[model samples]
Target chain A: MYQLLNHQRKEKLRSPFWTKNILMNILLGFLGLYLIVTALVVSFMAAGFIREEFEGRDVIEVFTAFLFYFFIFDLGFRFLLQQLPALSLQPYLTLPVRKSKLIHYPLLRSISSFFNILPVILVLPFFIMIVCANQTGLYSTIWIATVFSVIITNNFLNFILKKYFVKRPVLILAIFLVAGCLLYFDSIGNAPLSGYFAAAVNAIANLPFLFMIPLIIAALTYYFAYHLLRKNFYPEDSQTTRSRPESYSFLNKYGELGELIGIELKMILRNKRPMSVLIFSILFLAYGFILYDDPDNHFNLMLGGFIMTAAFAVNYGQFLFSWEGSYFDSFMVNRVSSFNYIKTKYILIAFSGFMTFVITLPYAFISYRIGFVNAAMLLFNIGISSVLLLLFSTRNSTSIVLEKSQFLNYQGTGAMQFLMIIPLLGIPLITYIVFLILGIQQYAVFALGAVGFVGIIFYRPLLQIVVNSFVKRKYVMSSNFRKK
Target chain B: MIELNNLKKVYGTKTALSVGQIIIPERDFTGLVGNNGAGKTTMLSLILDLIRPHSGAVTSKGKIVPETDEWKNYTGSYLNEGFLIPFLTPFEFLAFIGSLHGKNSSDVKDFLNKNRDFYTENIDSSKYIRELSAGNKNKIGILAAMLPEPEILILDEPFSNLDPRSQSWLKMKLKSLHLEGVTILISSHDLKHVTEICTRIILLEEGIIIKDTKTSPDTLVELESYFSVQV
Candidate 1:
């Protein structure tokens, strides 16, 4: 298995002229360094949670809540990026590979996944903080519990995920939604369960047989995941059964562009992967409203939500190049108007921007009663923000070539992404800060409108210029997007 | 008719295609042949104007090729599933493509009814493209491209992800389409099938056109050489 993985990596790096792909590699390398630095900062923070006084606060509660949500995020991304693509192997049964062995190797290789280490990295610090701050004697039993914590947690995460993918994706998503509400109510947000786990940790550290409990749970979770694995080993049998009627065939409600958007939206709704991103977008949009009790922070709330729209568009739009994945050759040879192709993406982002505003609009209007002015402001901001985003997106699309969504690869790591951030939020943030500096509290609404007005005036011509540049830069864009 | 004038494209520090001037004969079913890095894809991309030529120009019909959308009315293609919207069913996808060519929704449905066997898998008719396999996804893409019934059709690796029986069925369908005067250009590594179907075959090597053989009984030996991949 190790050899096989090594071979795969070598092959990935084998393009002879990839030596010229150095700029991309350096960008990827910097992103790696950033993640490591972030990890260290988190570890230091977790170490502080070791203090005894921290226990009385919501430290453990917050930790568990975030950890559980992280587990959901992990599970959602895994089902999409990893398990979803592995599904293609089902049609390859006639290619002479042993089905059981092929499934076994992928599953076995899955155990060493890159993501499994993140929770452990993030969680261990809090446990350590709980230990060292109390100055508890380094009892071997307490140490044993930590090891059990890793196993039981990892096993449960895997089992929940494996079981989810085994079913139809939508049904799995439904199960996830129901489970989330229950978990929030029954555990994380519930004082009893949080206290139980916290106190259980303290008692377990105090008891002689406390080590045995986690071991038992760990064993059971492991067994459950393994059993699920065996059942899914023969995916070919499930292929024909996985069929469903075409649910997204709405002839109305779309232009050629709009229909494309509708169909794309439907896939996102039905699949757990893209749906997770959308769900988070909705939550954050609403939560922006809920974040402050102070009425004055409303402006900040709108700005924060607007900022998030820029971020989501950039992150989501990166996939457009790869969305075509392997079919790029067809796009290359077909009679698709490059102008229309680029316009479709612009329209998609614009639609998302609209959605972001519409979702947050109710929150803004009901609370502020700013009325039609606010609605118009939102529409304008959305248009400007989406246009700016696509402008940045066009540049990024040129540089970042997406392959099939890799299982563990989250960030695509291009200098253009870095470049996007500087403009995506920076200009707006600077403008907002300047507004504050200018004693402009009364003019915040007018200022946002002014920005929107400017975006409207120049965005189309800017878009035309950008699309023309995109045509001229197609070589650069295609090659860059296609790079390692 | 499509004309290529010294059409060529090269990536930074490496050449991918350098096809000297050549014209695709009017109404010919042509097959493209090459190795993994051969210029087959690059040549096709140039013709469609998806990418600009590093050097030359391509013209379709009497116009200067795709300088306008005029040729699109006469062209339809399926390069792969990426050209497809995953959330759309085969029926919906076909309908949308048909509308692009100014057909009614019923016209699109009529096309699918005649070609339903093209999507005969038991997979959910109601599900989205994200739910389909690569092969099944390809099937929808092929259906969408053909529904428009354009004068020119282009396909890349069309027979991939298909069972042998399905492959035989598709070949027969292509034969009929060709008989009806649809000019087809296919890029594939499947030599035997290409030889059996195409009236012309262009062999590319290392981004250079080494052979542009029109299919005739006398060219059987050249076809054999390509089948065996002997330069």
Candidate 2:
């Protein structure tokens, strides 16, 4: 299994897409290192704050009391970021290898996962500086063992949770609802749960044998994952049943472009990657509250407006062409005109932006200016940002696998996708800044709106250019989409 | 009729296909037979306008395919799995294709009923194309192409992933469709199947057509011997 996994990794690294952009990799590497360092500094500072907060109380006990919250974040992060272990395990399924070994390969490979490294980075510095320096060898050992146990339990727990999510998504929602109820009782209903949790963590140091509890939890989680993988190893079991017609047929009434938009909507809602992006965009709509809470943070208001309205454009439009990469050839040979095809995409993004602006309308109560600024930004996003996104999207010929994890999984992203950020976010901001420096601060909003309005006015001619580009690149796009 | 006038396609340094002055007469059931990378798929792609030829053009009914949308009104094609939309149900996919050619859901349902044997258990089951078996997915692709009642149908390697029963069913369907005077082009590596169903056979070798002949009773034997010697 190790040999097979190593061979897979080597082959993946050798793929042209992976090695094509050296600059992106280096930038990503530096960004990762910077984040890790920032996390370490933040954790150390948090440790110091804990020391100051509890002057007489045992720092370890106080830390243990807060461990519950840490695990909450850990579990949530693990669920989102952890890559499923068996993505490349399909080829090995038909081989003579044991099923148990095949399943264990991904589980074991996950031990070295970045999810595991992150918690250790946040926890280790404090453990060494505070727990080790202040406690006996036995106390430190038990404390350290407790942390590792929770981390391991969280890891395997994710495996079980994700297995359930794949098999039955409702189970995950039910589990979360139950967890929410428990939190309510502990924090607001004066239940014994919080006391019990702190007791459990502190007992690890007071009674070293209590460390066995977490280990048992980890083992049980691992066992559950093993059974789940064993039961669902075959290809037949993996292909989920479609159950019923989840597509919306009502949109068919709007004629061909409407039907095309309906198909795009179904693609977003049914697929894993696009669905996640849709959910994330909805979640981002609440950012207006965060940014508009303070009037002094007006820059955040403008940025939020731009990002919020163009949320789908930034997230989904980056891979606009690649999203349909699998079936791009069918589009080429079909009777659909390039003009209507590109126009459907335009309506999808612009409609989403318009909807976001409407959703963020209640933020107007903060001040009328806030509402005006956001409206201008929304217009700019729909008119200018979406056009830029579509134009840049034409250059993207990379075929994206819709099944892959969307979080931090940069598969189809190229240098062109990276450059898409320039026009989407950078150009508007630069325009605003230049307008502000010109001493007509109030005109900045109107300037951005004017640019976007100009785009909207010339929508026909602009759409023609985009349509021509798409038609011109059909062959190039088709060939690129065909590549693995 | 479809005409390829000096159609040439190159991928970087390699010339994938370079066919000159080939006219596929209307109502001809032409089979494209070639080894892997022999430009069978590439040629089909060019004819369908899925990829552009570096030089020359493909004209269908006196209009260039890329310049005019008129060819799309009469053409139906399925080159491979790349042409299948995996997110959609088989019914939805076929219905979508039918809608493109001005057929409604009832028309699509009637079309499915006509070729029900090709799909067997898969047609009634509500499963996404991605969840279905490879053979079933291929069935969806072929059915989608046939659903439009097109005048020109192009299929590449239709028998590659199909079960024996499905393969035979498709052969019968193709023969029936051919009898209805629909111009059909098929590419396959299986010489026996090609010779059995196709009225005309074109053998491609190294991106160029080597043999273009009308099929006879001895065509299968001739193709077998030719491949055996080439190997």
Would you list the C-alpha lDDT of every candidate in the order shown? Answer: 0.62, 0.81
- Stretches of candidate 2 off by over 4 Å are A1-17, A43-48, A51-57, A65-67, A90-98, A166-200, A365-368
Which run of 10 residues does model 1 chain A get worst, by summed lDDT? A398-407
Which of the numbered candidates is closest to the native, going by highest lDDT?
2
As a whole number from 0 to 100, the lDDT of residue A439 in candidate 1 is 75
Report the lDDT of model 1 for residue A107.
48
By DockQ, the best candidate is 2
- Residue-level lDDT of model 1, residues B180-199, one tens digit each, is 99999998788778888889
Docking quality class, candidate 1 = acceptable
iRMS of every model, one decimal? 4.2, 1.3
Candidate 2 lDDT by residue in tens digits, A1-484: 6686886577668867567777778887898788689769966876678768868866666666566766876786677667667646678777898878887877777777777887788888888888888888998888888788888888988888776674444554566567767776776747756556667776777788777887888888888888888888886787665567776777888777877887888788778888767766766676676677776565676787786688777888998989999988778878887888998999898999888788777777877777788788877887888878888889999898897765666778778877889767788778768867886666676778877888898888988988888878877887889888
Model 2's chain B yields a TM-score of 0.96
lDDT of 2 by residue, B1-231 (tens): 999999899988999999888899999999999899999988888888888889999999999988898998888888888877888878888877887888888998888887878888656567778777888888888888888889999998999888888989999999999999999999999999999999999999989999999999999999998889542
